[model samples]
Target: MCYSSNGQFLTQIPTWLIVVAGWFVVHHLSQKRDQRKEARERVDQLVTAILSIEERAVRFHQSDSYQGDVARSLLFDIQRIIAKLKRHPFGSFVISPTLLKELRRAVTLKNFDASKFTRQEANSAILSNIADAVDDIEDQLEQEYERIYLSTEWFVVPSQQKNCR
Candidate 1:
């Protein structure tokens, strides 16, 4: 009954079907790409913030003020980065022992110099080395990001939970 002049059933094959299918495919692909990009940006920001914190930590030790001012600043940033890590849950990067040792030393130094311990030339070089370790971590993280993107599907990780464990 819906046949055309040439006996073709035009009503059975609606033209809009093809258009809708194409639209769905494009929309899905765009969303995937956008999500990947956003995830990458978040990772980059976390790395940069951590690196900056390490620099501040070095400067704090190097500064004349022996109070808790510098350590407080560095702690604030470390907390911020920790929060971000909780959200993304990418545990690929490991904290270097040297960096961890430096952080611990900074705490000890603060306690020891609570009243009167002047910054000496010998210790300044050690602080610089700690800052350099932080820089190395950042560079390693950037490379890891590139590898993750190339190897796996971006933000749509198969596991619903992105636990570091």
Candidate 2:
């Protein structure tokens, strides 16, 4: 309780209570911001992985003289991306069985030792399938990203609301 100079009563909230409520809001907002940043980084990584796969796939199909070094380096990067995805929190996006199967087939097509196909027509089919798979996966990732952004809420969680009360 508080009193004015004119002797009127006034309601008072303890300063400590106000500080605690502010703390909870700040802490929760910080946590959410961190999560959003992580999500963006993961999405960027996925985009890079998809683009690299597409570029290598297209080059493999178009090049008559196979560059083994470039192909091998691309394969290395792809494998690293796959491993990273396996460990990433975005398992739902990464673990599409169909997409994995298609990528595996593309890897087979990228096999330098076994894939010295003299004819461009022979490798054309694999290119078509891989291209289609890349497009589908990229589109899927983009859709999921959009969904995440669209569905996000700014309201505090029940736990935070409890702290405020």
Q: Point to the candidate with the largest lDDT.
A: 2
Error of 1 at 6 (Å): 11
**lDDT of predicted model 1:** 0.57
Best candidate according to TM-score = 2
Q: Please, what are the lDDT tens digits per residue for candidate 1 over residues 50-165? A: 76776666655666666476656666666555455546534544344454445445434443355764553535655656566566656655655555444454444424322323
How much is the lDDT of residue 122 in candidate 2?
42
Count the clashes in each prediction.
0, 0
Q: Give the TM-score of candidate 2.
A: 0.66
Q: What is the C-alpha local distance difference test score of candidate 2?
A: 0.63
After superposing candidate 1 on the true structure, give the runs of residues whose Cα lies further than 4 Å from its correct spot: 1-21, 89-125, 152-165
Question: For every model shown, what is its TM-score relative to the native structure?
Answer: 0.61, 0.66
- The ten-residue window of minimal lDDT in model 1 covers 156-165
